[model samples]
Target chain A: MNILMAVLLLGGLALAAGIVLAVASRVFHVEGDPMMERIDAVLPQTQCGQCGYPGCKPYATAVASGEADVNKCVPGGERAMLAIADLMGVPPKEVEEEAAPPMLAYIREDECIGCTLCIKACPVDAIIGAPKQYHTVVESHCTGCTLCVEPCPVDCIDMLSKPEVLEEWTWSAPGKASLVKLEGDSDARVA
Target chain B: MPGLLERLGGLFGGGVDLRSLISPGGFPGGVHPAQMKITAASPIVQSPLPPQLILPLKQHIGQICIPIVEVGDHVLRGQKVARSQGYVSAPVHAPTSGTVLAIEEHAVPHPSGMGRQCMIIEPDGLDEADQSMPSLCDYLDEDPAIIRERIRLSGIVGLGGAVFPTFIKMLRDQRHPIETVILNGVECEPFLTCDHRVMLEHGDSVVRGLNVIMHAVAAKGGIIAIEDNKPDAVDAMREAIARAGFEANIEVRVLPTRYPQGGEKQLIQAVTGRQVPAGKLPLHIGVICQNVGTAKAIHDAVCMGKPLTERVVTISGDAVPHPANICARIGTPMPFLLAQCGLRDLSGVRLIHGGPMMGERLPRMNVPMVKSTNGILAMRAESLYSENAQEEPCIRCGHCVEVCPVGLVPNELAWHCRNDQFDRGQEYDLFDCIECGCCSYVCPSHIPLVHYFRYAKGQVAHIEKERAFAELSKARSEARDNRLAREQAERAARRSKVRKSGAAEAAADASDDTEAGTSGAESGEKAS
Candidate 1:
């Protein structure tokens, strides 16, 4: 009779604990596409479709849904991949190849075949031209997506690397000046 | 005035015993370094003009100033040489009467090491002040807006190394009225005594400037904060407060000599006992903090109608033969000022702008001094900036945690930074760190904790910039897609209308043919 009473009491306690846990979860629960938003924010958002997805948002969705690999965003290089991996709570994997420096699409103006195919393909609306006139790209707005380069019928469009300029120069990370090192070196301690 | 009554309440004249309320209160971890104020004995001496002045257009912290004077144009002393671009910027004035020789890129005294637009002027040495300057008005009797305008026109900025335009700060929100104004006199940095000297010599001007600031903000009261270490500074300031008869409007608060006690947020907390929320200004807490030098500049601007051409700068170090405080002109080259102090050998000397603690090491000595320069120190190789600062692994001493004024886990932030986990560092409120170098000073491991924090901050800023660019691109892409869809829809609608009109015309032609056949048949029957 004592054993029966103890079992009943333990069952009641478990049920109460379960109800409390369920209520706590409901009270503390978050709403909205927080995971997708987080993943998308980490993306470079070039909308280049180089990752085999349509754009950065679509790829972010794919990564959140576990449909695409995190290492696929080549334009973002190692930085974006690491950031996404961090958000996903997964160990980062090495990419086979790092993305090269960003390149802007340059159209050879004299080629004379402005079929406007490149304009339609440009996701950023950086290209401006009539159906038959010469086309030009707004350099600032161009994402170096290469979408315009592929659709050019006359093969006149080419991607060029950005030129180095002083205005765009930024301060090197402060770590570059510090004595901190990943490897242990002699003469390291100074107090 | 209520401002006077409040000041009286803060003093012992009222019921509140302010001595009990006065304590060294601030944020989290911090370190108390040696005051090293040996140069406090030197009185303010006017620094002689240099042969050529290199005035960088980007003086105050904002958009670059637009050069109004062309090459070969003669500029008088205190004449506006450059126009301020926007409300956030301050106009740059000619330090002395000179001819604009060239406006080219010259090495500015910035840590970035990149040269910006600098106006090279050859001084004629007449030191001719502008004769047609604006008329001075009693700042107290004038409208607050007029006072702010006069302050802005004088090109006065926070001389506490922040270089933020003073006028912009004075324009507080009406919803949150400024209740208190604190002039930061706590020169907490080691090897810097310019502020201490400024108070001792120009106490009346500093108090009047505080009054003008209070008038501009319509604040109830003001406090001139000084370090307890500098007893002379406190006595001089108190005397000045009494002389100005502003004993009721302003009070003297002596803070314990601690590193970063002069920090805006730290000083605010020390004086008001209120913590300014992260990412919010002191104005949010009904407070406005100005530098002691800035207060003096405001008094000069409003009373004499003079522009901010010169300021009291502390020139001292072991490498210097004669270390003294000198009233130096803006845009004066570092070499000239260093020579006045009888600078020693330059080869092993590490020249730093501002105090030795937070001062930036000069890439080269020729960089021109701007409005925010408080002190210049030339340290011997083995002295202030120790070359043998051997960075060792963190021993997890919690010394940084104890000394941090912002109450941050600096070692953990440094760890995140070391491993390139800036996101995690940000989660720990990395930006909240003021980079006061206190953690590194107290660290037993000599880990250069501030360096890692700075690196982490820079990385976070770079990532944020990239993210902002990406957001802009995405918005553009979405807008472009919407435009294309709208245009496509319009074209489809137009095409359907054209098709419908053609169908109607064909149906009419068919009816006409049937009518013609019936008419022909009827005519044929009648003929028969």
Candidate 2:
């Protein structure tokens, strides 16, 4: 009789917990694409597809589905990787080091290869022109993705580094100026 | 005496800056370093023009100036070389009669290494000035619009290191009416006394300029507040004010001498006994503040129609043989100015523009002086470096918090910034920090708190730019998606319409059976 009573009490508690969880799920249910969207918002949205997926959204969906690695996003760098890791509750993987200066694909307009092949390959369609006309890439819109170059017939496309502008300049990080060198400090992490 | 916790509680205790009790009614946290007015007694002298004047197009804040004259075109003294684009910008002018050598990029006198487009004028030794002058308007009865236009055309900007366009700043905010005009005579920066000298030598211009500024802003009256340390300047300014016949309207208030008493917020507070809330301007508090030099420029601009081509710059420091006040032309190269001042053989001396607290270290001496450059300092190398210096951890001693004029805890803000937690720093009022360097100067741990704050500000600005870029990219991508969807929908509709017509023609052919199937085939295809 004592064994039966213990089993029945434990079973009852388990049944109650299940019912409450079901009700909570029903009442506080989130709609579609939330996890994907959360991941996508953290992405740099270069849409360069260096992450094997067609675009940032597909990559985000793959990430949400636990299929793609967050570290595959080369353009997003370490910040995006860390953000994705935090969202996935997984350890952040090391991001591949990019060249110091970012490169953008430039088309040599003088070379008479107006084959519209690159236009089809560009994920964002940053290049603009008719079939036989000279095409030019909008530098601002170009995600510096190299996908379009693989389809160019004349091989006129060359990847060139982005130029530095005063508007985009950022100050260097502050160097610590104290001599005391206290082992323990502010920001609340253990020494 | 209140304990540290109690003082902190008072500071963080709601929005009231209780540190206002520093003086009877003064803002909190000001450090009075040595008053180093080394060149106060030096009389103002006009420096001979250098071989060429390199006038940077971006002398003021806002839109950079567009060059009006071509490279080979000759320009007259005071001739407008570069025209400002918008309301918030000011133009550049030729300092003396010269031929335009070249409008090319050159290093500007700023912390950044970025070059700006400068109009290099090869001075023609004649020193021919712009003899064409506008009739002086009686500013007392002159239309405010005409005066504002004249000030704008004169390319007048705040010369007290904050180079804001004077005309734009003078405009009274609709929410805050102009009640008083405070001519900032409180040259509180250490080692800089150009303002004081101007008040002494050109006292009449200073007072008359104040009257014109007051007229432009439509303020009731004006006040020229000076630090009591310059009794000679105070007396001279008072007599000048009396001579200008604005004795009834403009009063000279000598505030207790303190560092940054000349700061716009502090000066306004010193004169009016009111604290301008964080992120708010003096205009928000129904007061318009103008630098003393700016008022004098306004006087020159409106009365003489002469552009702001020259200014009285204090060339003082231990490295200079003669630390005299020289009336230097705008865009005159720093080397020429130094040569005129008899500069010492500089091996490791650091060239600092403006005051030590807020001034920028000159990257190269070729960087020409703009309107905002008030002082040219050459700190001896011995004083700048300390061997075996290393960064130490913050002790949370709260000395920085105690001295913060903006009532922000610099140590915590620095910590947040260092840890890459900018949002937390913003929560603690990071943007309100005036970057006065008081906290860094007063830090017991010797932490470069101001550097950290500046880094954080730059990081915040970069993040804001990223956010804006993301917003633009998002909008563009969404627009592209919409365009693709609309095109796809239109193509589908056309296909469906063609398919429906083909089906109708086939049915008609079937109804007609074998009568003219072959002949109708081509016609049916064409119709579809």
Candidate 3:
């Protein structure tokens, strides 16, 4: 009789917990969009498939499905990658490289007949000025696609490397591996 | 007393002995060095302003502010000289009424000895003041967000050496419930007593500022954690807390005098006995920690309607004629400051920022003191060690291990870093290192472990960035390939569809012709 009572008590407690869990699940359930459009919105609309998919949208779909890695986008770099990775429930991978030297488009302001071909070729509209006017590359907006450079009749546009600022400067990591001597060697080699 | 029962009672009832208070703060690690507080306490003296102020555009940790005033523009003391770019940054005000000399890159207070965009202000010596201020009473009825904005506009930052913009830190998300606010009065570095004097002299304001922070975070209580070495500071704070009627909510916790106890994680552990996990902030553990100096700055900005323009700097070293804590205006040159302290010839002197243990060694004394400069240390040539000290191999003395506050095996990390085995160093949790210099300080071999770690972290960051770029390029290539394949497939399908329709049309025409031929044959038969 005692054993039966103990079993019945355990069973009843389990049944009560199960019911409570069911109720809680129904009450607190959140409806999430299957598309995860918000996560895709933060991505650089550059359609320059840096994220291992055919386009930004396909990569977004893959990310939402947990099939692709978030750190695949280089144009977005660390900051963008972090936001996407956080949304996708993944730890941010180490930034693949210190942001590649910021690439800027330099227009030889003097070099030419102001043909607006480069301006028309720019996808992001980084190039400014109307036809027959001096076209300049808004350094901030120029993605350095070289599409504009090729279109320039006078070859005025050049992809210039960003000037090294103090903030942008990082310490060179000590090359310790190179200091080690070859196996069965006598002296340490500084390569 | 009954023996066995009494012992058991003592074990249970004697709720955690007073000695448990000596147990260190929450985090795994910290560093300790020789305390050099005596340099300043000898006497409190004033330092005169420099002839020229080279204020860097990017003094704090965030975006550099654009110079609102151009060259030759006349500016007054406390004038709004530069405007902040974003919420994470702070505005820079004119240190003293001066003429803008140049807005160009100049040598900044950094280890790399690199140049940064600096605003050179030639002080006219008029000391003209800007008396413009918002109504003080308005703050009493102002929104918390408005108060925060005022603090940011004031250019206040963590004067505890981190120089993080205080306003940004104060803006906490309400979603994360803050349980406790830890006020860091630990002033744990050796020879740095600026915070100590601030607490002793301005205890009321500090407490008021802490109250404001508590209100901002809606924290249940606040703790003022100070090392027991500063009993006078503790007493002063205690009196102020009682006077403010915050005795119930705010308590003064006297921590054991240990090096680096002023560190955020260590102090958190020593006070709360709750370890902030690796790679997490104290806020994550339901606590928000602010330096005593930062809290005082907040009070000044919110209550006094003042921007962070001046700070108390401890000028002390063996070589100085007189060492004292002086209220220095930001952008004061080190040479001029030293001269004010009666140091004439600096030909063979070594100047360091902050305390000698963790402070960076200045390449030259010409660098101006920015918001983060807490202490200026000058030592005679004989007393200073060469930058490149002869490094000896590790003798396995375990001194570095003993002094490490984070409980990391520094020797292992250093070994991996030295061997260029970054992966191995990472495996030993190299990122967890705070680079506090305790291991380097205790090392008999003078291995410069902190430098090795910095180098390794930089390398890792670079490699990681390169890998990301490569991955991006690969992804782009793959995407192009996929698009081409899809387009080709679509073109093939369209071509096949067109061919099928053309065959059907051809079959219909042939059937019509056959029908016509049959009709013609029938007509001919009738004629015959």
Q: Could you say which candidate leads in DockQ?
A: 1
The native-contact fraction of candidate 1 is: 0.30
Q: Give candidate 3 regions above 4 Å deviation.
A: A1-107, A112-162, A173-191, B1-32, B40-44, B126-128, B135-142, B380-382, B385-388, B468-528
User: Higher DockQ: candidate 1 or 2?
Assistant: 1
Best by TM-score: 2
Candidate 1 residue spans exceeding 4 A from truth: A1-41, A52-68, A83-91, A102-121, A128-139, A146-191, B1-29, B172-174, B384-387, B482-528
Better of 2 and 3 by TM-score: 2
Candidate 2, residues A1-191, lDDT tens digits: the string is 99999999999999999999999999999987898989988776667777888778889999999998879888778778988999998999998756234667899999946788888677666888887898888888776768888888889999889876555665566664432222111221110
Candidate order (DockQ): 1, 2, 3
**Local accuracy of candidate 1 as per-residue lDDT tens digits, A1-191:** 99999999999999999999999989988885678889988788789998989988889889998888889998899988888998988889886677878789988889948788898898888898987899998898888989988777789998999864434544454436532211112221110
All candidates: TM-score of chain A: 0.73, 0.73, 0.49
DockQ of each: 0.20, 0.15, 0.08
After best superposition, candidate 1 residue B119: deviation in angstroms?
A: 2.3
Q: Each candidate's lDDT (Cα)?
A: 0.81, 0.80, 0.75
Worst 10 residues of 1 chain A by lDDT: A182-191
Model 3 per-residue lDDT tens digits across residues B59-170: 7888889999999999988788899997678889888888999999887777666778889998898888777856343444667678777778888888889887887766
Instruction: Quote the positional error of residue B1 for candidate 2 in Å.
Output: 14
**Model 1 Cα displacement at B232 (Å)?**
2.3
* Candidate 3, true inter-chain contacts retained: 0.12
